[model samples]
Target chain A: MGSYNWNWPILLKEPYFGWIVSGFGKTILIAVFAWAIAFPLGSAIGIARTADNRALRLAGTVYVDIFRNIPLLVQMFLWYFVVPELLPADWGRWVKRDMPYPQFITAVACLGLYTASRVGEQVRSGIEAIPRGQRDAGLAMGLTPTQVYRYVLIPVAYRTIIPPLTSDFLGVFKNSSLALTIGVLELTSQARQIEEYTFAAFEAFTVATVLYCLVTGLVIVIMRIVESRTRIAGTIAVGAQ
Target chain B: MFGSFDFGILLANAPFLWNGMLLTLQLTALAVTGGLLLGVVLAVLRLSPIKPLAWVVEAYVNFLRSMPLILVIFWFYTLVPKLIGRPVSGFYSVLIAFVMFEAAYYSEIIRAGISSVRRGQISAAMALGLTKMQSMRYVILPQAVRNMVPVLLTQSIVMLQDTSLVYVVGLRDFLTSADIVASRDNRPTELYMFVAIVFLVICFSASRLANQLRRRYSL
Candidate 1:
């Protein structure tokens, strides 16, 4: 009992206070960066998988298979600690020296790449869900294949994938905690710091839990709205009963 | 620099890596098995006639689903030991966390599978003079389980990949062991590439098996 003391005042004071706020900022930054990178890359990979070109499909499949199978933490550590060292000496030096946010870069890159595999699958399904006649109609209207995809395929696919994409966004948000291992000061890292500084593990983690729930809750609400709005007509009516 | 990535190092460390691999598989097996059992129970609870029971299960699922796995792992590691006033091994701690975290997800999957079962199947089973429990046991469960194989396999692959996260808790799983070897030898790219390949092989096989099952069971 003596070991557990309630110290709300200490938690709110200098250093601890700044650390938590910055940690929250970093977590949001990591999630946003990861999502931004993942979406385009994943969409490209997804498009590539269904492309008529064999090589593109092969490359896309391999990339998705490899990235999706491995764990995020392992990939992050590899990128952060291993990849730079394997580079040519001068290049490695530049990377090691010039990169101020090595951990952050690694976190974002790993999370993005990992998430891209999932989003790629979602995008592929979304595109496939679109009727082939739509693409034919685009072609019939004198649009090139590229134009057809950009103008017709992509817009429809993006809209269709919104629900899955939202879940992926949440996944990236949760996975950002892996960044803490590489020493990026995210929410979980800040909690660890607070616990170390004040020995208030329970309170620090409780705060983190609340913050996580709040962010995830917000994402869920937004996704539900997007899902309902974008839902195909009569699907729910038919689904419900 | 590590002398052009010596295969000899990996060969020498093969035994250690094998141990870690065994632990990783064991962890995934235990977690998935425990999770599925707990998940089925929660799924049943979610579908129970009692409103309060269903509400409790829903809350549990939502809370677990929303929380990060790392935080859950950490919380369980700390709370379990403190509450019991005895040290739980890191291995069991991770297993417990995985089961708890995964059960929520599995419950949803199971529920979906159950719901997808046609309504008339139950009525027809009742028409055969079977009790409601007997109908579910003899008819609904088999059909749901059959249709659920592919999805469950996918979830199993996810659990396999997620086992790597246990490294954070200092468990000597494959990823942690690879990290140790890579850090010690300074050959991060080669070692991590190897680890990635191992995971790819495992997941690829699981997915292939899932596909085969899907084709076999296709209506």
Candidate 2:
């Protein structure tokens, strides 16, 4: 494992150190925004999936299938290039011309949509796992269907699904690195940049890899704490995957 | 732009794209087979009684899983040649990276499959005079594999989509070939769209097969 000079000190020097830290921050920012987008959108679609209306169910399924099937890179490119061009002329011009943080927005949207599909699956299975009587009891208590979902079904489902959702959260964090391909200059791209500049490929990547593990490990620990606290007694078997 | 769409660029470059797709399939096959072999070995070690060996394997798996696949490809691409004291092709470098990274995931799948085989089955086999390794080989893995077929297929689909990431290593995978044509003909839209369509079609079919497997296995 040690053929080259292992200069661990290089990462602490002025430019490389700042570059890596900023990249780490960007990566975290992307993950947070992506989760912000995925969670609510996924929850809505997940609710639609369990709805009695046939059209809503089909719409949810189609959204999941289309977004889930395409490779994330392709989706990123599509959002950045094809989608903007597909808009009306003035709007397209605005996207390609005057839009602020175009790459950032596109990457966030692509990641959010892509990750929403996976989260939606978790949500669907979670809602389905609740006892049928829960829905009936909510309705029997003079609540509307939406209120039943909001008050009874969704809350329970979300609690039971914390663990799986945690994995999905970690997954989105990892996938955000793919934003580098679209020229987002996130953590992985920063590693490549450092490698190109200093030829310290091993050191640069090792540092970045450690940073990634640190972030993900922290997420796992936090999620486990949340999971332990929210765990419902005797109802743990619901969507346990 | 819609009225001026031109797939002539894609049509002429069809053979090149086909070659790229073949290369992708070749890579996927090699990685899945090689990774599964390595996965079986790792899974066995993980299931073993030795704590330190299991810990080492766990760390390796968890670390790789935590990092992005693209980073792993880059890491191996830059470091492997240095370690081996010679130059290597992009294909070999990417292949090694894929095999190593996918092995972590496959080992997890295999380990879960192995664990699903009941404790009694292993104990019963031991009582019948089979060694631990022999019992796992003869009695446990066979049933575990049957239960695990669907998940393996699902993971393979994921691997297939991930093959496109090899483009970063300068490997002309399905997406890369399209990018080449797009640049050559000055038609990014048509060519990239074509690549996306091809990916969608292939991935959708594979996902359908996986869904079928899920239904069958759940039954």
- Write model 2 residue lDDT over B154-213, tens digit each, in one string: 888789889889988779988888878777877778877887888788878888987787
Please, what are the lDDT tens digits per residue for candidate 1 over residues A53-145? Answer: 999999999998888777777788778877788889998988789977888988999999999999999989888888999999999999998
- As for candidate 2, its clashing pairs are none
Task: Name the top lDDT candidate.
Answer: 2
TM-score of chain A of each: 0.90, 0.95
Question: DockQ of all candidates, in order?
Answer: 0.60, 0.67
Of candidate 1 chain B, the 10-residue stretch with the lowest lDDT total is B77-86
The lDDT values for all models are 0.85, 0.87
Best by the TM-score measure: 2
Cα deviation at B177, candidate 2, in Å, is 0.9
True contacts kept of each: 0.62, 0.63
> In candidate 1, which residue ranges exceed 4 Å CA deviation?
A1-9, A232-241, B1-3, B127-129
